[model samples]
Each structure stands twice: as C-alpha cells, then as structure tokens.
Target: FRLAHISDVHLGPLPGVTYRELASKRVVGYVNWQRNRRRHMHDAVIDTIVADLKASQPDHLAVTGDLVNLALDGEIEMARHWLETLGSPDDVSVVP
Candidate 1:
C-alpha cells in the first residue's frame, strides 16, 4: 500500500486568540505567529497540499504535528473540515 507522510503543516490564519487564553507559554507562540508565521502561512497552502496528496492517490495518508497554530476552537474546527477532504478516517491518520 502506498503511504504519504506529511508533518508540521502549522496551519494558520489564526483565530481570535485572546490574552486570557494565552496567559502562559502560548503567548509566545501567539506573538511569533502574528509577527513571522502568519505572513508565511495560509489555508490555501494546505488546500494545495491536499490536492497534490490526493493526486498521488495514496492508499493511506499520515499527517502529524499541530495543524492549528494556536489550537483555538475555530482552528480545530477548521482542521476537522480540512481532514475530511483528505479521505475517510480509515485512510488517513493525523491525531493519535
């Protein structure tokens, strides 16, 4: 079976992150994403990646790392929608 592996996608265009939510180390990650990462990241990038991966017609796909930069509710929901396009849960692996 063919297997395609991708990691550290770091999907962004982050959600409405609040100061209260980032009252810890996440504050650092939030700041970094805003200054540096956001410029380099976009949802379309992930769409292109998924398109290419699908074109390859892999028997299985494995995705790793934090799909959302901030792990916000919106981001997690977005990740869920994106994951569906990759194929069924039986054919893809992201979270454990």
Candidate 2:
C-alpha cells in the first residue's frame, strides 16, 4: 500500500489570538509565529502540495504533528477543517 507522511505543516496566518490565551508557554509560540512564521507560511504552497498529493492518490495519508502554531481552539478547528479536506478519517491517520 502507498502511504504519504507529512509533518510540520505549521499552517499559519494565525487566528485572532489574545493576550490571555498566550499567558503561558504558548507565549513563545505566539511570538515566534507572529514574528517569523507568518511571513513565510503560505496557503498557496499548501494548496499546491495538497493538489499534488491528491493527484498522486496514495492509498493512505499519515499526518504527523505541528498542525497548529499556537494550539488555540481556532487553530485546532482550522487544522480539523484542513484535515477534512485531505480525506476521510479512514484514509488519513493523524498524529497531531
């Protein structure tokens, strides 16, 4: 069977994060994403990758960690939606 493994997606343009939410260890992640990740992360690149992967039509897709930058509720939901776009749960296995 063919398996595609993708990790460190780090999809950005983070959600409207608040100071309260970044009150702990998340502060560092929030700061890093705001300062560094946002500039480099591109949805177009991700889309192109998804399109290519779909074209390949692997039997299964295994997605590892780093789906979110800040681990916020919105980020999780965003990850969920992104995951849905990939395939059904039966076809995709996530380690995040």
> TM-score, each model?
0.89, 0.92
Native RMSD of candidate 2 (Å): 1.1
Task: List residue ranges in candidate 2 displaced over 4 A.
Answer: none
* Residues 1-96 of candidate 2: C-alpha lDDT, one tens digit per residue: 888888888986688988899998999998788788887776987888878887888999988979989889998989889999999999999997
What range of 10 consecutive residues in model 1 has the weakest lDDT sum? 38-47
- lDDT, candidates in the order shown: 0.83, 0.87
TM-score of predicted model 2? Answer: 0.92
Worst 10 residues of 2 by lDDT: 33-42
**Candidate 2 accuracy as lDDT:** 0.87
By TM-score, the best candidate is 2
Task: Evaluate residue 65 in candidate 1 and report its C-alpha lDDT on the 0 to 100 scale.
Answer: 80
